[model samples]
Target chain A: MTAVRCVDLCKTYRQGEVDIKALDHVSIEIKEGGFVCLSAPSGGGKTTLLNAIGGLDKPDSGEVYIAGQRIDNLSKGELAELRLRQIGFVFQAFNLIPVLTARENVEFVMQVQGVPAGERQRLAHAILDEVGLAGLEDRRPADMSGGQQQRVAVARAIVSRPALVLADEPTANLDSKTADELMELFRELNDHHSTTFVIATHDKRVMGYAKRLVRMLDGRIVADIKQDAA
Target chain B: MNLVFRLAWRNLWRHPRRTWLTTAAMMFSNTLLVFMISLQFGMYGLMIDNTLQAFTGHLQIQAPGYKDDQKIRQTVADIVPLAESLRAELPSVSIAARGTAFALVSSEERSYGIAVFGVEPAYEPDVSTIPGLVSEGRFLGDIDAPEIIIGAALARNLRAGLGDELTVLGSGRDGSFAAAVVDIVGIFDSGIADVDRSITEIPLGLFQDVFFMDGSGHQIVINAGSIDGVAELQSKVGSLLPAGQDLVVHDWDALQPGLKQAIKADMSSAFLMYGILVILVAFSVLNTQLMSVLERTHEFGIVMSLGLTPGRLGRLVLLETAIMGALGLVLGAVLGGLVTSWFSVNGFAYPGMEELASKFNLPARFFPQVSPLTLLVGPAVVFLFTLLAAVYPALRLHRLQPVEAMRAV
Candidate 1:
């Protein structure tokens, strides 16, 4: 099954009297349980494409589908519901809610989904353990290191076992070893749970972990290549 | 809802100093409102009681048109018997019969025109304070005693004193020449210049004989326990009157027309000041909540992107404000109530209050009327205003674009 698809997406932004095309006629498809990496330089439109796919932003003209459900035409509330139920997102920085503990941050989505407290607590603990943050569940984001905070954000993203995960520069603030460990965790989750992964990055180390690599320049796709796992 | 509440409560403490400062403003305003409202009401009660009890009793049964015009012929016939019947029916009330006429009283050296009231000597003290306020000599003794008690100012004007002989001259009810020689038995200094300079009292029987009243009197004054029960007492007195009698029962407010209007005007001005205070506190709340919302733009964006609706986020903001408002209300009311209750028991007096009170026949200290209404009404208004103040901040969430909000630093 095709887990995510975009057809002829176009988006434009105005920067003080100049029109910048963030996305131009971009089209891509990712199959179920696929690990794909979108590689680009700074301001290369990778984050914009990820935002469009997650329904966090709308294209000027396009069709976006998640798990075969068209989402580009959804209302803000409807988009929020879709993201809560079907997709998980991890941003580069300021991910976790500062007021919540690590475990509570991980449980936020399920709690909004009306999960029972006991069940939410159980799932949140399990996800924290899986992310190598078992005993640090009670620490707030401010109290944790950058790597640990990113791990908490990653735990929160996949805690509900969403069918698709969209991550934008998830390892940007991490050290080299932490970035490699995070990529390994993403690969392990993808292989074990059949969860489709779409990561936007420019790092060669991150692109090496993908089964498929798509390259972009200035909002247009320039290359598509398939490779074996790292 | 529990999760929302939990998040809202935790978020309020993110900046503990700001929260406390806002809460303190609300608390201080609420406390001031409670105490001031209570004290104002208490002062009003004292004013009404003092004004009413000084001369005009809580209620009076008078001949129709007699209050507006003091014509001697317009009289309540058999007022003594009527007062006796009313006293029997309302055992808790003080009842007395009286007749009033404008008379020229002449002493050995001088003479002046004064309003002379004929009062039941036995029951006069029960209904009026004038008998108790005698400064010299004694009140009238026998039912038919040809004696009178004059105010100090009136005595000073007539050059009269206790035991002096005075000639009372007035027109009788039958339009005949009324004249008598009466001995002054008492003099009272009521501290009110108008009442003291223009009023005197004589025995009801003597007034009847001198004024040709023929068993008719001008008014039957009744003093209930307090001003609070005046309306009910008036109604009871109205119902008990004879069906054919042309008499009217007037409560203290009815008899003193300017009194109610004066109180209403004072209240309007007081509430205007109170309104300003409440609005000031509301603006403080607005400032705090607005700053809080602006500071957490990115966090709000993250929560919105996580599937929390803008409506829910707005409700969370209001919830935080409500928690803060509730804290102010409870703590302020408790503290205010304590302070007001102490004053209510011990009485409160300001500087020079004794001297000022002595000039008007008023009590030196005032007690605050601390009831539940006085305590809660002010705090409830503050709580509502604070909630209203939070609305603009809450509505700002609906306009947020998650993509843009997440981009905020």
Candidate 2:
């Protein structure tokens, strides 16, 4: 089943008198459990496309689907509900709430979801352990290193066991080894839990870990290639 | 639910100085308001009490047209019985029968037109301050003593002293020539210029006899309790009056119509000053909350992106405001109460206030009321205004688009 499908997505950004097309007639589909990388250089629309798929941005003209439900025309509230329940997002910078510790950050979404405190705590602990942050659950984002903060952000995004995780340059601030470790964790979640991932990155090392790679140039897809299983 | 609280509380300390500055503004303003309001009420209480004590004793029972027409003949019929009945029915009150006459008081070389009150010596001190304010010599002697207590200023004007003979001349109740020769038993300085210059008190029996009335007196004055209790006490006194006696009750405000207007005007000006202080504190809160929201744009975007709704984020900001407001309100009220109580106990007085107070026979010290309403009303208003000030900033989050806010630096 299709986890995410965007048909002819179009988005534009205006700077003073000039209009820049961030996404133009971009179309893509990812099946459940698919590990895909959206590879693009600066000004090539990867972040815009990721934001559109996560319902964080509304495309000027497009139809977005997660698990076969049309999402383009949904109200802001409905879109928030869809993102809260079905999708998780990891941003490149400023991913974790500064005031929340690793464990509390993981529990943030579940708290909003009205999960009981005990259950939320249990899930938060388990997710932090899975992300190799068990001993650092109480450390706020500011106290953690860049890589650790990213890991905490990743844990928070995936803690609720959402079906699709959309990440925009998730490993941008991390060292090489930390980036490799994070990719390995993403692959594990995809293989073991059937959780699909759509990562937007410009890093060539990141593209190598994807089972499917989509490359874009000036907002249009130039290549969609499926490689051997990682 | 607990996590939300944790988030809101911890978020406040992120910039401790800013939070404290905002909270301090509210606290300081609330403190000033509480202190000022309490002191104002206290001074007003003294002002009203002293003003009323000059002649009116909170409430008075008089013949139907006596207040409108101060003719000596418009006396409450059977005033002694009526005063006795009031005293019996309301034992908590100070009731006194009075006969009043505008007469010529001549002593030595001075002959001054004075308002003479014929009062019961025993009950006069209970209902009026003139008896207690005797600056030299003494107040009028027992109910039948042929003596009068004139104000100190009157004494100065008359150049009279204790045991000096003073002549009183007035038209009698039946329009006959009423005259008397009395000794100056005491002189009072009631702080009030009018009372000091043109008033004297003699025993009711001597006054009625000298003024040619057999048994009638002009008024039966009663001091029930504090001014706050006057309405209820007035009603109680009205019920106790024997029906169809041609006697009616009048509260101090009705007897002195200008007094209520003076209080209203004074309070209006005071509240205007207090209102300005509150508004300044509110704007201070607005500045703090807006800065907080603006600086947290990226953090808010991250939360919203993580599936927390914008509405929930807005509410979280409001929760933050409420927490801060509650803190300021509690601290401010407590501090304000403490300071007011300290001042209330010690009493506050300005340099020239003593001289002004002495005129009305008022005490030099002003005590703050320090009641629950006075303490809470100011802080409650500040809390509400702080919340109101925060609403714009909190609601500003509702218009925040997660994608754009995420991109904000």
Candidate 3:
């Protein structure tokens, strides 16, 4: 089953007198448990497509169905609920709230979902351990290294057992070794938990971890590449 | 709902600078509001007590038609039957009966026209402190005592001291002429120059002789059992007056209507000023909250996109405001309360108003007393105003879209 499907998705930005098309007639689908890398260079609409899939941006003219619900038809609150319950985002900047600890950041999503305190703590600890940061649960994002922070971000994204996770350059700020290690965690979560992973990145290391690659340029997907069989 | 509240609590600390700025502004306004109001209440109480105690002896009784027209020839003599009825019915500490007459008091070299207050010396002390305020010699000895306590300035004008004889001449109640010889037994300085310059206290018998045996007082001053008992005593005393007699009883307030009117007017004006100021402060509070939300537009989107409801987002903003307001209110009230308590105990003085103070016959030291209303009313008023201020900002949050918010960055 497809965890996310977008047909002819488009987004436009109007600056003063000029209209900029960030995404134009983009169409794609990532099935459940699939590790798909949306690879593109700068200004190739990789981030825009990821934003559209994550429910953080609405398509101007097409349909986006996340877990069978047409996101374009949902209200703001409904979209928020969809994102909270089913979709998780790992931003390029690792945008963990500066004041919250690693465990707390992961627990925040569950907290908004109205999970009990004890259950939230338990789930947050379990996810932190899964991401190989068991004893670093109380450390803040600032206190962690760039790689550790991204790992915490990855932990937070998968903590809620979201149906699909969209990571926009999750390893962009880390070195090669750390980036490969982070990709291994993503592959492990995808293989073990069967959670769908959609990564938007320019890094070749990240692209190597994908079972399929969708390449984009100038606001359009130009190539769709599949590696070995699943 | 509880989940939203949990998030809202954490949201307040997201930007410590903005939160503290808003709280500080709120505290500033609250302090100003509380202190100004407390001072106004204290000043009002002081003015009321001073004006009454200075002249009006809680309650005063006037003869029928005498207050309306002094020339009506209906002196206290007209109410002889009513006077006996009053004494029988009212539980007065003492009823100091007096006849007032426009008279000329003459010395060997100079003469001055004055208002004479005739009194029973034995009853005078119970109603007024005029006898106690004597500066020289002595006051009236008995009902038949021919001695008089001359006004201090009047004594100076006549160059008369103790044991000097003065002739008093005035018209009788029957339109006949009357004359009497009186000795200046003492001099009284009533502090208020107007009263001290013109009022002369004479014995009731001497006053009756001067007014040609009127055999009654034009006014009966009644002293109640105590200040606290004045209201009850006034009610009981009202039942004593004869039904047919035209009498008007003036309480302390009625006796000094000018002072009461001034205080009422000042209090209303002060209240209006403070009320407007509080509303303005509330607007500043609103501004602070709105600014905070604007600054965190992207963060709000993050929280909302994380599955936080619009209601929850709005509630978080309101809760943030409430926490800020509650904190400011507590601090402002504590500071305001401490100042009020200090003023209550030590009494704040406006030392520069000595002349004005003296004119009003107030003491040199002015002590502003703080009431309980000052302490409690300020916090309640601030809390209500603050909560009301948060509504618009909280509502504004509901109107914000999560997509637009997330795109804010």
Candidate 4:
């Protein structure tokens, strides 16, 4: 089964008198448990594609399906519920909620998911530990470094154990060492939990970890390739 | 719900200074409102009590038509015994029988027309403040003494002084010629210009002699403990009046019919001012909440992406406002309550207050009446307005799109 499928997705943006094609008749499919990398240069539609897949953005004309269930026509509330239940997203920067501590950030998704408090806390702590942030559970995002905040965001995204994780430049602000560690963690979650990963990034290092790599230029895919585990 | 409160409370502290400034605005307004309302009520109470004490005496038992027409013949029958019986039946009440007649007073130098009150000297002190207002000589030396107490203004008008023989001429209860020779035994400064300019008092017996009455008086005044108890006591005392004796019972409001309307007008003006103050504070809160939400737009977008619906987010902000309002209310109430309680016991008065108070026959020190109503009304109004103010900001959240909000920069 396809974890995500977008058929003829098209989105447009207007700047001054110019119409910018952010997505143009895009069509793609990623098999269940597939680790895919969507690579594009600045403003080439990687983030836009990730947003569409996560139900954060609606294309001007497109059909989006997650786990083979149509979701492009969902209401804002319905889309939010779908994202809350089945999808987890990690943005490039400004990920963690500044007001929440690391453990609370991780617990937030599960908490909103209506998981029991005890179980939520247990899962949050385990995920924080898995993200190498066990003792820093109470550090707010502002107090944490960029790398630590990214780790917390990653922990938050995976805490509820969603079926799919859509990440947009997740390692953009991290140090090379932290970036590699985060990619390794992503790979571990993908292999062990069969959690499908679709990461949109410009970083070649992050792209190196993908089982399938798709490259886009001017909102059109120019390359589609597959590779062994990093 | 607990999670929402936690998130809301945490969000409040994100901008501690802004939150405190808004909360302080609310608190200060609440405090000022409570104090102002209490003072207004206290002043109203004093005004009513002083007005009633002057001559109205909370309640009066009178003949049916005497109030409308001051006919000396329109008298409550057997007034002395009737007043005595009322005083005995209601121990807490102070009842005095008095007769009033329009008479001509001649003091050799000048003759002036004045309203003369005939009273029982002993019971008059309990039922009226006139007995305590004498600034010269004394109040009706003895009830049966052929003496009179004239107001200073009246004395000034009549050119009469203490120890001077005054002649009073008036028609009697039966329209017969009634006349008396009385010594001015006292001069009272009632402070009220209207009261002082035309009022004089004499013993009830002498009044009867001068008015040609047979143990009957114009009215029996009763001061029943406090103003708050007047209506209940009026009913009880009214029930005790001799059945079918053709007497009317009236409370102070009936005696001075315009007092309630005057108070209502004044209170409406006061609340209008109070309403403005509350709305200003509410706007201050609203501005703070909007700024806070605007600053946290990205954070909200993240939360929304994490599965929190816009409605839940809106509710979160409202909960935040509610928590902030509740906190300010409690703190402000406590602070206002403490100040009001202290002033209520020790009294609050400004310079020249004594002179001002005396002008209206009011107490020198005015005590604030801080009832539950006073305490709750101000803070409750503040709370309600704060929530109302937050509605605009909370509704703004529902319009935020996670995709767009996350890109707010």
Candidate 5:
């Protein structure tokens, strides 16, 4: 099954009287249980494409589908519901809600999905332990180190076992060892749970963990390559 | 809903100082509103009771035209018997019969035109404060005694003192020439210049004989314990009137038309000031909530991207404000009620209130009424306004673009 797909996506931004094409006629697809990395330099439209796929942003023109469901035409509330039920997202920074602890942040999506408190608590604890944050469940994001905060964000995204996970610069603020460990965790989750992973980054170390690599420049796809697991 | 509430509560304390400052503003305003409103109502109660009990009882049964025109001929016949019958029916009420006429009262050295009232001296104190305010000598005792009690200002004008003979001259109910020589038995200083200068009282029997009233009097005054019960008392008294008698029952409001108007005017002005205070507090809330929303723009975006609807996010903000408002309301009302209750028991007076009250024949100290309505009305209004103030900040959430919002620092 195709876990995610985009067809002829186009988006534009105006920077002080200059039109910048963030995504221009971009299109891609990832199959079920696929691990794909989108590589791009700064201002090269990777984040915009990820946002469009997650239904967090509307394209000036195109179609977005997740698990074979067209999402680009959905309303804001509908998109939120779709994201809550089907997709999980991890941003580069400021990921966890400041007022919530690590466990609570991990349980946020399931709680919104109306999961029973006991079940949510059980799942949140298990995910925190899996992310190597066993004893830091009660710590707020501000009290955690950069690597730990990113781990918490990653735990929150995949804790509910979503079919697809979209991560933008997931290792940008992490040290080298922490980044490698995080990539290994992502790979383990992808292989064990059959959860499709889409990560946007320019880091060669992060791209090495992907089964497929897609390169972009000036909002247009420039290369598509398949490789064995790192 | 529990998670939302928890999130909202936790968010409120993110900046504890701002939350506390905003809550304090609401608390202070609510407390002031409670106290001032209660005090105003209390002062109004005093004003009404003082003015009514001073002379005009809470309700008066008078000849149809007598209230509008104090003509001697327009009198309630057998007033004393009627009042005695009412007193028997309503044991709790105080009843008195009176006859009024404009007469020339002359002392040995001077004379003046004054309104002389013929009162049932024994029952007069029950319905009026004037008899209790006698400053000199004694009130009239003998039912038919040729004696009178004049106000100090009236005595001063007529140059009369206790035991002095005064000549009372007036027209009778039959339009005949009425004249008599009466001795001054008492003098009262009511502190109200108009009443003191213009009013005099004599024994009802003596007045009947001297004025040829023929068993008739002008008014049957009744005091029904409190102003709150006056409406029911008026209805009761109106129904009890002898059939076919051309009499009307006038409540204090009817007898004193200016009183209600004065209370309404004062209330309008006071509420305007209260409205200003509530609005000021609401603006303070607006400032705090707006800053809170602006500061957390990125967090809100992340939450939105996490599948939390904008409507839900807006509701969360409002919930936070509501929690803050509830705190202010409960705390402020408790504090205000405590302060007002103390004053209600001990009485409150401003500087020089005693002297001012003495000059106007009013109570020296005022009590603030601390009923639930007074305690809650102000705080409830403030709570609603604070919620309204949070609306602008909550609406800003709907305008957020999650992609752009996550980009905010």
Candidate 6:
């Protein structure tokens, strides 16, 4: 089943009477539980497409659907509810609350969603273990390695069992070795939990882990590639 | 909602220095405001209590026309029969009758102007404590002996001591020039400079002879059986008295306009100071909260993006402010109470300006007392101020757009 679809989506940035088209007439669909990568060079509008699909930005004109709901038609609050129930996000910046420990950062999403305290703790600890951060539960983001922080961010994003995970340059700040490890963790979660993953990245290593790849340039998709298991 | 509160608490502790400094500023202002107001009230209370109890005795009564005519001899007839009737009418009351006249008191070397009070020594002790404040000599023994008691200042001015002869000359009620030789039997100090330097008390017969006054007293001092029962008793006394008679029955508040005016002015001044302190504390809290909110713009956006609703964020900000306010106010109340009690017990004293002190007419030792409301008011005021401060931050939280805030960097 298709979990996300964009029909001729357009996004523009205005800078003092000049309009820069970040995404123009772009359209794509991702199946449920699919591990997909949106690959493009710098300024190719991959991030803009991810931001629009994640409900963090509005398209200038077009349609976006997530889980059979018309996302562009939804109000901000409704989009927020949809994100809370069905979407998880990992950023290139590892946007963890600096004051919270590794496990607490993961538990924060469940907390905001009003999960019971005990259940949130239990699930947060479980996700941290799944992300191979089993014993570093109390270490803050600043105290962790780049790879560990990214894993913690991933654990936080997935702790609520979200149906779709959107990762923007998840490995952009990591060493090649750490980047490889993070991709392996993503691959593990995808295979084990059947979690659908949507990654917007220029990193070849990140796109290498995806089972399906869509290539973009100048705000429009140029190619779609699918891979079969060995 | 609990999660919002928990997040707010954690956020507060995230920057401990800012949190503590803001709380300290509010706490200091709260303590200062409460202490100043309570001390002012306490000093006012002590002055009123002492003045009413020791000097004025709560209320005074006078013949209908006599207050306007305090001269030793006036046209109003002697009202002794009416006075005795009042005594019977209010038997449980403390009452004294006195006649007042101006006279020249001389002791051979010097003569000074004096206010002569004519009183039945036996009945005077129940009203004012003039007899109790004597530092030297003794009170009048009998009406026929024609003895007088002078204030310490007057005694010094005339160079007269106990048993010294003093001459009093004044006009009699019948317009004759009256003169008498009297013994200075006592010297009393009532702490009021005007009263201490000029008042001289003589036996009623001596005053009546010197001024040739009628038999009735010019002024009547009355104390109800209980302070609480005064209103009812005054009404009863009024009903028993003759209508159209020239008399004045005044309560304690009416007796001393100076003291009442001072208290009112001090209370208003304290109220104004408290208002300014509240505003200052509110601004301090608001400034700190606004800074923190602006700094955490990106964090708030991230939380919002993670499904933390704007309402939840707004609640979180309010909850944090309230918690800080409650803690700061609690500390202020306890500290303020301690300071109030310390001042109340020790009493601040001024020693240098004896004349100025007397001129201002306030007591040398100022004792500040605490009311129950004094301790409670500081915390209530701080809480109110803090809540007002939270309004801006709470609004900022509610209006935050998740996408824009996340992009704030």
Tell me, by DockQ, which candidate is best: 5
DockQ for candidate 3, C-alpha atoms:
0.40
State the lDDT of candidate 3 residue by residue for B22-54, as single tens digits: 677767767766777787776665666555554
Please state the CAPRI-style docking class of candidate 5.
Answer: medium
Expressed as tens digits, the lDDT of each residue in B89-163 for candidate 5 is: 889989999999999989999989999899998999988999888999998897789999999988888887999
Candidate 5 docks with a DockQ of: 0.79
Candidate 5: segments with Cα more than 4 A from true spot: none
Q: Candidate 1's residue-wise lDDT over B76-147, tens digit each?
A: 999899999999999998999999999898999988998989999999998888988899999888878999
For the predicted complex of model 2, DockQ is: 0.75
Candidate DockQ values, in order, are 0.66, 0.75, 0.40, 0.64, 0.79, 0.44
What digit string (tens of lDDT, one per residue) describes model 2 on residues B308-372? 78789888988999999999999899999999999999999989988877764568888999999
Q: Tell me, what's the RMSD of every candidate? A: 2.6, 2.4, 5.1, 2.7, 2.2, 5.3
Minimum summed lDDT over a 10-residue window in model 6 chain B is located at: B71-80
Q: Which runs in model 6 stand beyond 4 Å of their true positions?
A: A71-78, A176-181, A184-194, B1-10, B13-15, B58-129, B139-184, B197-251, B254-258, B274-278, B350-357
Model 1: how far is A116 from its true place, Å? 3.6
> Roughly what TM-score does model 2 have, to 2 decimal places?
0.94
- Clash pairs of candidate 6? B42-B369, B63-B246, B64-B246, B64-B247, B65-B246, B172-B211, B173-B212
- For A1-230, candidate 1 gives per-residue lDDT tens digits of 99999999999999999999989999999999999999999878999999999998999998999989999999988998988888888888948988889988988788889999999999999999998998999999999999899999989889999999999988889999999999999999999999999999998999999999999999999998999979
Mark the 10 consecutive residues where model 3 chain B has the least summed lDDT. Answer: B72-81
RMSD of 3: 5.1
Query: Distance (Å) between predicted and true CA of B328, model 4?
Result: 3.3
lDDT of 3: 0.78
lDDT of 3 at A43: 79
Worst 10 residues of 5 chain A by lDDT: A86-95
- The Cα error of candidate 3 at residue B44, in Å, is 3.2
Give the range of the ten consecutive residues with the poorest summed lDDT in model 6 chain A.
A221-230
Off by over 4 Å in 2: B107-110, B210-214, B359-361
Error of 3 at A67 (Å): 4.0
